[model samples]
Target: MRAVAALARRSVRAGSGRFLVEGPQGVRELVRYAAPSVVDLYVTAAAAQRYAALVESASAAGVFVHSVSDEVLAAMADAETPQGMLAVAQQPEPTLADVLAASPRLLVFLQEVRDPGNLGTVIRAADASGADAVLVTDSSVDVFSPKVVRSTAGSLFHLPVVTGLDAEATLAEVASHGIRTLATEGEAALTLPHVDLAGRHCWVLGTEAQGLPDHLAAACAERVSIPIYGKAESLNLAMAATICLYASAAAQHGTQ
Candidate 1:
């Protein structure tokens, strides 16, 4: 119990080169994916019985499983109500080069994004849109933070997520690959729907409160906005990103 609680801390996770994935969905997907990095699995006794196949699969994958009381499961999880399952796995990271090498046509870059929930939603949206990868700038929140991980609902493991890069340098790097970088702005005259997204596009989103910094916004090849048809002042950061990314996805995939 003490060790499980300790893994909840970021410092401990960092030092141990391992992170916790809570709930049955995340753990089941981890096992289904056959991710070799998963080292440990914890579940409640009832949960083990209910999800016998899942437990068996994890065992077949060679992940050590421990059946404990519901109390122990809660103690290990970051959430108040852990869905009776959790897994400890190594945190995987990829570089800008790795993202580019994949020849991803659609990409989303989270620039200076500080909110863990918003960042996680952004990653999920990116995955849903089938973006090549999601790049999180160095100034963004810890990608592997508990809140972010839970919010992602396991989409964090679905796609290549490049982290800890300078926004400006990443912009330049993707631009060289013929990937036009666009900074999302709520008020910019150029709306997302009107843009020509026939080729690769990397949409860069700023923080929730400040949006993108002026300097970084200026650095992008273009600054584009999502049109607001309703009377709402503005869309939430995650909402705007979804609209922009899907717009690109629709435009590009429609052609293919």
Candidate 2:
């Protein structure tokens, strides 16, 4: 129980270099990715009865399973309704250089993004779009926050995410890699679909209320906007990011 509580705290996660993954789907993803990395697995007796197959699979894979009290499991879970199972897995250290070395060179830089849900959704979209990685600036919320991790729906395990980058330093590093940086703005003359997104690039999306910082926007090789004819003042950051990523994916595949 102390171990479970420790895993829930960010400072402990950083010190231990591990994070918790809850729910059957999340645990399944961890198993599929690699079972040996899982430090500990916990499930209530009720959950074990409900998800016998999953429990069986975990046992077959050599994961340490603990059938704890339902109250204990509930206390460990971030969700209002606990899913009954959770695992502590090592968090891989990913860097900008490492991501650039990977395939698809296309990356997403999130600046000062406060909402974990939005960040997680953007990470999922980035992964689905075949992006090399997602970079979260230091001003942004912690990627390992429970809300963000749960919102990721386990996509976090499939993609490389680098956090704690200063805005200017991040831009400079990405630019040094010869990757074109595109900042999205509602007022930019160019629309996302109209831009050539096939080249190695990094798309920068800012906070919801305030858009990109002026210096950062100016650093971008191009400023692009999404076309909207409705009464909505602006698109949600996650929605804007998804549209831009897909547009880039389509352009890269020559389907645009």
Instruction: Put down candidate 1 lDDT per residue, 85-106, tens digits, no spaces.
Output: 8888888867889889888899
- The true-versus-predicted C-alpha distance at residue 8 of model 2, in Å, is 3.1
TM-score of each: 0.95, 0.93
How do the residues 1-256 of candidate 2 rate in per-residue lDDT, one tens digit apiece? Answer: 7766677787888788888888888888777776888888999988899989988888899999998988888888777765888887888678877887664468899988998889989999998998888999878887887778888887887888998888888888788878999999889999876898879999998888898988899988899999997889899999999999998888777763
| Model 1 TM-score relative to the real fold | 0.95
Model 1: weakest 10-residue lDDT segment is 26-35
lDDT of 1: 0.86
lDDT of 2 at 37: 85
State how far residue 7 of model 2 sits from its true place (Å). 3.3
Once fitted onto the true fold, the runs of candidate 2 whose alpha carbons sit more than 4 angstroms away are 254-256
In terms of lDDT, the poorest run of 10 residues in model 2 is: 96-105
RMSD of 2: 1.8
RMSD of each: 1.5, 1.8
Give the local distance difference test score of model 2.
Answer: 0.85
